[model samples]
Target: MFNINYKSQHPIYEQIIDQTVLFLMEGVLQGGDKLPSVRELATSLGVNPNTVQKAYGELERRGYTENIVGKGTFISSSHQVEKDLAHQFKESLKEIFYEMSRVGFNSDYIQQIVISVLKEEEYVTDTKS
Candidate 1:
């Protein structure tokens, strides 16, 4: 299931893409699991079919999903999926770091913030478990 936030600055397709990747990373969507058809998802989300198609297209490009002729799109099973996701995360982090650096934030400060956030999240997760 997808949730769209109309107020978010992120485009609908990008939001879908991000949520799909998060689902895959969290193991909520596993290998060979079928994705909702574009039309079905669009209707459910009240978005254009083209937007859903764009998200699926990006997922396929990133090796997260595969489209089988006559069979709906399914999550990829290759270990490469994890590798690709890790690489994407690194790239995104690098971009964030660069932006912060441009704004005069030092590496140490960024690292401290990151570590603190990670620790807080870990603590919360541990408590929940």
Candidate 2:
């Protein structure tokens, strides 16, 4: 469920963190879903177990996952987890918008693009429904 690009500029741990969060947000991973053990994930990804452990630690710190002494790690169901994820997404979007503005993108153009994308997604969802 996760892919690692050794040549990518992004660190392996960061990639793991991002993928886990994306999975959670997309509902591919729901609350109480067991995450792969560090050893299993490390072996599958061909990375050091330490890296996976670090990613899991970060997820736990961010309230995305919780560890049970004997049951392995599972996704958290706390409402705060969703709120935190939303806030993180908003901050990332803000950074992207600021970068675009720095490169001469105007607010009107940005709004139009965003609205267009949203409308297209809504259309797709409606058709699927």
Candidate 3:
């Protein structure tokens, strides 16, 4: 299932990619799961088929999905904690750190913030169980 927001600043294809990643991260989509065809998703989202194609292309490029010649696009079997994802995560963190530094947040303060968030996450996980 896909959720599209027409008013969002991000492009439709990017939103689709982000949501697909979220789905994979949340276990809503599993390894080897087949994705809807581009035309079907485009019809559901009321967007051009090319937009969904673009998103699927990016997903494959990012190692999230695999496209078979005649069958269909399927979720990557080794979806959990792949090298591509690890690199992407690091890049995202680097961007965040750079922006925080640009806004006058020192490295020590950033570390503290990250540690606090980690503690809070642990607390939440403990309570959930």
Cα lDDT listed for each candidate: 0.89, 0.90, 0.86
Better of 1 and 2 by lDDT: 2
RMSD of each: 5.9, 4.8, 5.1
TM-score quality measure for candidate 2 = 0.72
Model 3 Cα lDDT, one tens digit per residue, 20-123: 88887688987899999888899999999999999999999877999998888999987343665677779999999999999999998998887778778885
Q: What TM-score would you give candidate 1 relative to the actual structure? A: 0.68
Identify the runs in model 1 with alpha carbons over 4 angstroms from their true place: 88-129
Clashes of each: 0, 0, 0
Among these predictions, the greatest lDDT belongs to 2
User: Which sequence of candidate numbers ranks them by lDDT, best first?
Assistant: 2, 1, 3
Candidate 2 C-alpha error for residue 121, in Å: 6.4
Candidate 1 lDDT over 61-92, as tens digits, reads: 98889999899999999887889779888999
Residues 94-124, model 2: lDDT tens digits? 9989998999999988887777777788853
Tell me each candidate's TM-score.
0.68, 0.72, 0.66
Task: List the candidate 3 regions with Cα displacement exceeding 4 Å.
Answer: 79-81, 86-129
